[model samples]
Target chain A: MFIKIDFQSETPIYLQLRNQIIEGIAKGHFKPNDSLPSVRQLASDIGINLHTINKAYNLLKSENYIAIDRRKGATVLPLMDEPDMAFVDDLKKTLNTLIASSICKGISKDDFLTICSKIYDNFREEM
Target chain B: MFIKIDFQSETPIYLQLRNQIIEGIAKGHFKPNDSLPSVRQLASDIGINLHTINKAYNLLKSENYIAIDRRKGATVLPLMDEPDMAFVDDLKKTLNTLIASSICKGISKDDFLTICSKIYDNFREEM
Candidate 1:
């Protein structure tokens, strides 16, 4: 698994790690049932604290992105086919903020949609 | 000014307040140069701590969504016509995570773009 950490970024290291893993999974770098590196190994590889890596893993598990097994540790779960109502609501709330910020920044509707389309296409290509 | 806080939410209270204020601005409930309620007033209104509201206001100021004056307190700033390169980079990083999550949730490209278009249109209507 490939991961990069920017120690200087305002984003917490654990959250950054979580986002990178999700991006990696989306980009086809990690497949369903693929085992993730153990917390100790990943901590050494990324040169972060073991507790930070553990926090990231715990978050991922809670979010249903991955599952932990007694023997295999953490493995990626298959993509969910239907999002729950709560997930949809959360997505809308997030999009609301982004859209507001974009409008305030004077991003044209065409430009904004174009960016969304392009990003969506990038993920589609991986499918 | 209207604000709602869910104590049960996983997101921090300060962030929820910040996002709601941004959404309010985008929806035209808050015009450029409109004065926000004092931190004390808003905190009491929403029944949250004054410190939490202060934190949200400070973050909005740092993001240039609002400005703090000695006497006037925090006032909304006019939207910027040009986003800085750093802002664009941050926007892309956020979109990347959102797009990846959408893909993993089996949201089709059309559906995703439609959602984006609808939200952008909502902001456009307020202009």
Candidate 2:
């Protein structure tokens, strides 16, 4: 429930929240059927605008992370299986774009893979 | 330069452009002092709005990746060194947040690290 916001980060706040929540769910921090803090409460806790928190909630809803009940508030949904093929396809497209751009920039395939490997190794999480 | 836009990406288009340009410079696709396409031209080429292209250009300028000379248009700047400690620190903060959230969600540290290592090794590039 302790979320830090990097105001100066190039990433948008809503994205940060969405990613954090998704990661949280992936790691199993929130159990199925658990209730999320009310949007207003989360906004006050995070000290961000309500609209921003609402935006995150809306995104989560779209992704099926949580369901909104008119009177009961937002409740956590069970984590789904690994990302769908559509999501994987989207990821491939992004990586392909990045790879093509790197090639255009003169980054050899070897160097590009090396950098990514280094980053992955350096940041590997202990699961 | 041809840039593709994903209307459905969670990331902002401007950010995507900024990251792509930075990576491009790192890979040497653009030489020092190369001139970038004008906003209108780039927008037309990419099939995006002029304002979107302008926004990306503006962000690049702020990051010192490009120089905007009123009459001359946007010109690429010399490639900078590896990211500074400040940038590294920011990246660390992000990863730490992701790790902590994962831990909260019941992801084991070993598993996380293994996933990261696999990603790194799988994607490692040759210099």
Candidate 3:
């Protein structure tokens, strides 16, 4: 439920809210079936207009990231069973960029492998 | 030079273009000092309005991903020496979400580690 907004960023407020919520859900901060704060409450908490929060919620609904019900409000959706091509393509592009930057910084192959192994081990330890 | 516009997405076209260009630079598709297609050319290529392309270009310039020269045109900028905290935080958020989804799907820790090692090896081989 902790989210920060950057008013100085070029990205719009609604997008920032939408992205953070989605990222939060993905990162295990928000679990499936978890009810997010009502749009009004979230708007008040974040100090943004209710309309902006509504815009973000609307986006989440459209993206299938959340399900909206009149009585229950919004609930997190389960992750898809199979990854979409678009998602995989986007992941590949991001990894390529991240790897390129690491290499450019003189991080050797062994060191990079060590880092990924650490992340992998951390995941196993956590889950 | 080939870019497509998603007319239906909630994301604004300008932001989409800006992200794509930044991702392109990170993926090594665009080299430093490599001139991007002119704003006019890009606008035509993507079938977006000139103003929208200009907005995207303006954002890239502000982010230091590209330098616009009146006489020389827009040139790609080199990646930063060290990853910024903000960028790393953003990356963590994304990776956490992605990993959670994979785990939820029963992708074992071993399989996940294999994937990362593969990505790491690909980086070394490519570089």
Ranking by lDDT: 1, 3, 2
> Taking the candidates in order, what DockQ does each have?
0.69, 0.14, 0.25
Model 3 global lDDT (CA atoms, 0 to 1): 0.70
DockQ, 0 to 1 scale, candidate 2: 0.14
Q: What is the interface RMSD of each candidate, in Å?
A: 1.4, 7.3, 4.9
Best candidate according to DockQ: 1
Better of 1 and 3 by lDDT: 1
Query: Candidate 1 docking: what grade?
Result: medium
Please give the ranking of all candidate structures by DockQ, highest first, separated by commas.
Answer: 1, 3, 2
Best model per TM-score: 1
Tens-place lDDT digits, model 2, residues A5-65: 7899888999889877766655556667888888899999989899999899898788667
What overall lDDT goes with each candidate model? 0.87, 0.65, 0.70
Q: TM-score of each model's B chain?
A: 0.94, 0.70, 0.71
Write the number of the candidate with greater DockQ, choosing between 1 and 3. 1
Locate the minimum summed-lDDT window of 10 residues in model 2 chain A. A118-127
